[model samples]
Target: MASDYWDRYFRRARRMRTSRRRFLLGSATVGIGAAGLGLVGCGDDDEEEPTATSEPGETPDPTATSEPGETPDPTATARPEETPQPTATATEAPPDTSAVPTDGSYYSQVGEPFVGITLDIHRGVSGIAGGVEGSAYSGLIRFDDIPAPTFRGDLARHLPEQPDAVTYIFDLRDDVVWHDKAPTNGRPFTMDDVRWNLDRQLTRTLADGTVADDFTLTNTVFTHIDSLDYVNDETISFTLKQPRGTWLESLAFAGFMDQGVAEQIESDPDVISADRIVGTGGYMFTEFVPDGRRIAERHPNWHLRQAGEEVQYFDALALLDVGADVNAVRIALEQKQVDWIGGRFQRQAYAPEFMQAIQDANSDIERLDVPALNANRALIYSWEIGPFSNPMIRQAFYLALDRQLVLQQDFAGEGRITGPLPWAFTDWALSEEEILQQPGYALNKDDDLQEARQLWEAGGGEDLEDNIELVANEPDAVRLSEWFTAMMNGNLGTDKIEVKGIPGGSILPYLTGEDPIAFLTPVSAWTSPDPRQRLARSYTTAGSINFGKYSNPGMDDLFDQAAATLDRDEAISAMKDIQRLAMTESGAGTILMAAATGRFLKWPYLKMEFNPWRLPVDERSWIDQSDPTFSGRPSL
Candidate 1:
C-alpha cells in the first residue's frame, strides 16, 4: 500500500475505534492478562486434518447482512464466539492422484475461490487498494515466487533492460489484451498503454492533457524519467535523468492500469469506481460494496491461458473485508467460508496465538512460513515530537527496550532482533559482529538498561513515565508495547508508563499524525531486490513514507549517492552507510526484529504457490483436482 493512503486509513480506523468505544480488553475472554499474553505453545499437532475432497458447498453470500457472510462490525470483540461460522462438514476421502495434471494446469472443483483479506481498498489507485488489487492486477515484471527474489515478465514479453544504463527499452507482448469489458472493450494491450501509464505516473497527466493530481502517489519511483518515446506499437523506450539500479523493479507499478481506463478515470473522476476500475489483468472488476466485499470474475481472454483453454482456473475471486478483526477472519477460515487468509504485506495479521488456534482447530490448514525480505518490525520514534526530539532520549529509549526478550516472549523465538535493514538482505545488511558494535542491538539487556538510565538522566531526566505513551494496534504489537511499558517502569524505577492498543488500521495515523511520540509497527520495503528503494522510502528527506519525520542531511546524502550510481558494489556500500547513520548517529528508529517468519493458511482443497513479494493468496490460484471430492468434475 502507498504510504499516504495507509495514513488516511489509519485515521479512519482511529475514528472508528473512538466512536465505537472499541478499547483493548483487559484479561477478560482470552484468559490472559495484558502483560501475560506472551507467545505460548509452538503449535498443536493432534487435530484432525481436513479432507481435500470435502463436498463443495455454496459460497457465502457477499451481500449477506448477518454474521456468517456479512462484513464484520469494526466494534466487534475479538472473542471467537462472537463471530459466526459456516456449517460445512469435512469427510475423509482418498486422494485422486489420477486426476492431477502434470503440465502446470489444475482444474478447479470450486467455481470461484473465496479469499478472506483485511486491508484498506482504494478504487482508483493500484498499490493503495491493498492485497485484492495486488493479486487481481498484473505487473509488467514480478517476483517468481517466495524464496526466489528473481523477477519474471508478467505483462511484458521479456524483462526490460537499459542498454546504456540510462535508457530502458520495454518490449510488450502483443497477445496481451484488456478484459472484454466496457471502457477498454478487449482492446489489444500495446506500448501506448504502457507509455501512457508510465507518463501518468511521472507527470500525472492523462492522454487528453488533463492533470491528474490523485494519480501521483508513485511519482517518486518514476521521477527519473526524462522522456518516453514510442518506438512502435509493441515497443517503448524511456530516457532517465541518471542510471538507477532499481529502475526495472519500479516499472512494475506502471503495469497496473490500461490507457483507455486511465483516460476515462482522469476525465470523469467518479468513473474510477470499483466496477469501472478496468485493467488488462486476469480478472475483470464485477461488483464492489464498500467495506463489504469486492468481486471480480475471470477475464475469459487473458493472454496467459492457451488458445481453446479455459481462461481462469476459478470462475471468480471474492475478497472479504473483515476490517482489522483478525478473530473474525480466523473464524471465517476455520468454518471453510473463506479458503485462505493473509495476502500482500499481511505478515503481521497472524498473531502467535491465532496461528496456534488455527493449528489446533484444523490439521488440513497448512501454515507456510515465508521469508520476509526487507521487512522489519520496529518501534518508530517521531523525531519531530517531544522527548523523542532529543537524540539522547531517542538512544535511551532504544536501550531501555529489551528487544531479545520481546522477540522470545512475543514471537516464540521465531525471529531475530535486527538493525536498520532486515536480516534477509544478508549481503547489504550488517552482520552479527557489525550489528553488535551498534548501541541497543547488543545481547546484554542489563548493561544496555544501565547505559539507558545514565543517558536518560543526562538528557534532562524528567519522569518520562507519565509524560510519554507507547501505542500499538495489532494484538502482538499491543503485547510488545505493554511489555516495553513494563520494562521502563520496572527497570528504570519509574511508576508511570502508559500503553494504548487499537486496531491495526488505526496504527498508521497514530504514528504519523501530529507529534507522535513513539509507535510499535512493522515497516516493509518495496518488493524490489535492490535496497535503494527501501532506503529512499524510509530515510530520505522527502520520503513519502517517512512516518516518523526522521530527516538527516547525512542520511539523505547517503541515499542520494546510492540512487545516483549504477555500480552494484558502490550502491551497496552507500546503502550500508545510510543504515549505519540512521540506526546509530541520527537515531531514526529502533529495529526490534527482522525477517520474522510469516504464516499463511490455505485449505486442503486449494492449490497455490505462496508469493511473498505479491499477495499470498493470488488470483491465479486453482483447486486440486486430484482430491476425490472435486465438486465440478463431470459425473462418470
Candidate 2:
C-alpha cells in the first residue's frame, strides 16, 4: 500500500510537471495533492519534534487519510452519568449536532486558557482556542505535520520555491473558505488575509499604529523577511533581510489571522475567545465555557476537499477540560462518557492504573505507548536580569541537574537524554553517545558536581539572595521543579533555589512581561521537522518566547547559515555548532532534559490512522461504530 501510494505520488509528480503548484520544481520537491498523505507518528508535547520510523537510509512507509464522511452547535455534552465498568449508559442526551455526525468525538485535557483580551494562539495557547498549535489554524503550508514532516500544502497551493537564499515564491490555493461565522461570514480566504496576518507577525505595530501585544507573539519567525509581495491574487513572495536556514520551515508557525478577528480584537480587545474564532480550519468554534467545556463544529463549506466531499470525518469536535483529577478522567474513559483521554502533552495526566486496566481488559482500545521526546526540556533563566546572567552560574546549574535521575524516578526510565533537538528528529539532532560526552551529561557526575560548586563559588552566586525562584508551566512540572531544587540545594548549598508552581494561564504573561519571574520551563509544542526553526523560535534574540532574553549573535548567524545552506552536511554542522553554543559552551541558556515515553488511550471507534500530536484532530479521523471495543459507548 505504501509503495502504491508513492508510485502514484511519483506518477502524479510526473503529471503535474510544468503545471499548477508542481510547476518547474524538481521532481523530489513536487508535492502530491491532498489525496495522498505519508503516514506519520507524533509526540504529544508543547514543542514539536518529528519522529521518523525509517532506518538509517531506508525510506519510511507512507499512509493516507481515508476520504472524509461529511460533518454543529456545541452544548457541553456533559459527561453522561457514568455506569459501572461492567456496563455503560448515558443519563443525559448528546446535543443534536453531535448525534447527527457518525464520525466519532475525541476528548482530551486542554490546559487552562490564556486570559488576555487578544488571542495568543501564536504562543500555542489562546484565550479561547485552547492549544491552537495545529488545530483552529492554517498556515501557508502544512509543512510541519508530524511523524513525517511532509510538505502538504494547506493555505498555499504547494511547496514553495527559494529563488535565492533570501527570497521565497509561492502560488496560492484558490479553494479556501473561512468558517461560516460572524465578522468573517464564510468569506473567501484571500491574499489580503495573508498579508494582514503576516504583517502583524512581521511588525509590532497594528494598522491603527497601536502596539500589538499578543498578535506579535510570533514575530521571531518572520524577523528575516524584509518585505512581502502579492504577485496577483494567485501568487505571493517573501524577500528576506538576510539568508536564513529556517526561512522556509518557519512559515509553518504562522497560522493565518482573519481581518475581522483583528478588527474585532482591536475594537473590544475583550471578545477574542474561542467564540470569536474565525479560522480556516475544518473545525469552527461552537461553544466555549471557560474552564469547563469547549467545542468546534465542522465547516459545511470547508474548502479543502477530496473527491468533492468535505475532508473532516467528525461532524463536531469537543475538547473536554476536566481538570487535574486523574480518577475523574479515568472514570470518564472507563464508562465511555468520552471517546479518548491522556493528551495535550500532559502524559502524567493519565494515571498508571487506567493504563493497567486497559491492558488487563484484553480489548482493542487502540492505545499507543510512545516516546515523548520533545517535552523533555529544561528551564531558561532571566539571563538579562538576576543570578543566571552569569555564565559560570548557568553552566553550574546545568552541570548540577541530574537528568538520568529525573528520568529514572519521575518518568519511569522510559526515554533518553535530549539536547537542542529531541531524539525524535532522527535526521538531524546530535546522537545520544555524542550528547552523553557533553560536560553536564556525563554518566559519572562526581567531577561535574565538584566543578559546579567551584563555578558557583567563583561566580559569586553564593552571595546572591536566598531561594531563587524556579517556575514551571504546568502541574507535572512542579514535581520536576521540586526535584531540581532539591538536587541543586543538596549539591550547591542547603537552601539555594525555590520552586514555584505557576498555572498555564498566567505563565505566559509571567514569562513575557516587563519583569518576568526568574526561571521557567514552558511546554512549547513546536511541530516543525527542522532544527533551525526550533532555534529561531526559542533560541534567537527575537524568539517569540525568548522569556529569559538569552541571545548569542554567533548562534543566530549560524542558524541563518544553516537555513540558507543547501548542502546537508554543511547545514548539519552549522546546526551542531548552534546547539553546542546555546546548550553547552557560551550562553549556557537552555538545559536539555529527559524525554519520557507515554501511553495515549483512544476508543476503538476512532479510526485514527496515526499517532497525532495534540490529536491534530483533522479530516482523516472517522468512527468505526461497529468496532467491538466501542461496544458500551453511551447512547445519544
Alpha-carbon RMSD to native, per candidate? 16.1, 12.7
* Top lDDT model: 2
Q: How does candidate 1 fare on TM-score?
A: 0.68
lDDT of 2 by residue, 308-413 (tens): 4325776666656655676776676777766655533433344456566765674555555544534354666677777777778777888887778766655556
Clashing pairs in 2: 39-63, 46-524, 46-525, 47-524, 47-525, 47-526, 48-526, 48-527, 245-563, 245-564
Candidate with best TM-score: 2
Whole-model lDDT values for every prediction: 0.52, 0.56
Candidate 1 residue-wise lDDT at 128: 26
RMSD of 1: 16.1
Model 1 lDDT at residue 498: 64
lDDT of 1 by residue, 357-476 (tens): 787887666655444443234666677767788877777777776667655554455546676776545556677678876777678777888888887778755655446676665454
